[model samples]
Target: MTSPQILIATLVAAYLYVVTPGPAFLALFTLAASRGRKSGAWFICGHLIGDVVWGALAVAALVGANRLGPTLFEALGFACGLYLVYLGVRALMTRKDALPRTIGAERPLATGMAFGLTNPKSYPVALAMFSAIVAPYIGALKAADAPQMFVAAFLGFLLADATLIFTAGLPAVRKFFLTHGVAVTRVVGVIFIVFGARSIVDAAQGAMRKTA
Candidate 1:
């Protein structure tokens, strides 16, 4: 088990990663601007669940599943990067005058989950956190302790993501976004595209480094 100090340190590290506006936040921002606050909240719920699962899987990989895990995740990263870029392009091309349609609960939830699960940077960031902050303290932890570690890491993810979603949905924030919805969407689209391009470049570099 991790000491209390180590646990706190790990959560703090995770928050640093989660709070940074990355692909995940870019995706959420697009949804909140185009759809609405309710949809953004649902998306946040889905993303939180995905983060927990990803955190657990990262712990499992470190514990034993490394043989195939890294390769599989890299491939997913490439695919997801492409998809994100496409979404960005689509957002930019949204009809000039038409308002964004109200998104159903299921759509945003599923979209958020997919974005979280396939976020190209997540695995690498988690690995870095483990090496820099977590592994130093819990290197001696047994496999049985994986679940506890996973939960600790996920708390940070939940808090960071939930905060962003709720803040974006605040009445003033939402009204401003909804008022200039088209402009907001275009801005988010640009952010997504740039982020996606970066993901692709990073994934390619990682793959090359692995092969070399």
Candidate 2:
């Protein structure tokens, strides 16, 4: 594949990866529904940091230059899992008459950054997604191409972020969230707990594997 082709492939892969529903999607939707597009935008901005970091790492790994150890990521996964479970519990315990405050509405940027950086699945998912789409071109890729590929991926992230912002801010969507905020919060909470538990289990398994 040529440079342009590789960049386009990376962009498409990144876009698809971001749009796939997961913790970040759930959190973004919740924030946009509860707050507004501006809040969602801020969250996306913060999340971009993680996206870039993980994207770069994925590219590095793909290029046979990965030097980062698995231990650091495993520890981060454990911590992130615990934090997610804590947030889920808080959401689950929200009063019916009260607004849900577990999603860090007051500090959306930080919350988003935390969500993005600490997501245990981010690195592997990114790697898998990129590999699935861009692996065919790996033989054609060169060291100089990494930066351009990353730039394309960044553009993809921005596009997906815009899509989420628009979708979350739609009047009907906002109205639905407003009408059933409590239920939605609880439901999201349950999902978060499940994700957290899965992350915890995966991290533990990874640790055990390492020990053995």
Candidate 3:
């Protein structure tokens, strides 16, 4: 099992990443804003189901780590770290007005599920979080232990996403968030950069240990 501090850090980072505005948020926002919270809940269910698949993939990668050797894990850390830094920079550079704000249809559940499944970012986000934060402590637990962490992470995402969708359905709240979206995104970008740097350091340390 991971130390309590790492576990808390992983959960916090996961929540922050999930809440950052992106394709998933836009999709949910459109649906919730157009339809209602009830529709949004169904949409969130679909999204959660898609996230389950992502969580499974993360666990699979961790399990595979045991066999592929430490070098592979180090390489993965570096790759995910660089990717995080790239995403952070991109988020920081992009203006809020440049993003899409299309309205949604009545069939929110199906569309939401489709969006969740098709959105390319989910897998990479999962990989980055797992590689940067979870990988170091994964060895302490049995391979079977991965599911619990996945479930916990998914619940956190679901709660945060559901709340956001519900709140965004309200015109005033949505307006406030959208108005301040740039500030929120900047904070998230900084957090991502910090995590990315940590991952790079961890990768370097792992490589050095292997060389030694």
TM-score of 3: 0.78
lDDT of 1 by residue, 1-212 (tens): 55676567557656655654445655566577666677888787777766776666656655552345455545545565676577678778867785544443458888777867777766654543343344334335456666666677778777777788777777787666556667766765675566556556656765897899
lDDT of 3 by residue, 32-66 (tens): 55566677677767777677677568656765775
TM-score of each: 0.56, 0.65, 0.78
lDDT of 1 at 206: 59
lDDT ranking from best candidate downward:
2, 3, 1
Candidate 1 total steric clashes: 0
Worst 10 residues of 1 by lDDT: 129-138
Score each candidate by Cα lDDT.
0.62, 0.72, 0.67
Which one is best on lDDT?
2
Question: 2 or 3, which is superior by TM-score?
Answer: 3
Q: Kindly list the per-residue Cα lDDT of model 2 for residues 86-177, writing each as its tens digit.
A: 76787788789965343758888998898889988788666655655664465576667777887888899889888888888897987776
The alpha-carbon deviation from the true structure for residue 95 of candidate 2, after best TM-score superposition, in angstroms, is 20
Clashing pairs in 1: none
lDDT-better candidate, 2 vs 3: 2
lDDT of 3: 0.67
Best-performing candidate as measured by TM-score: 3
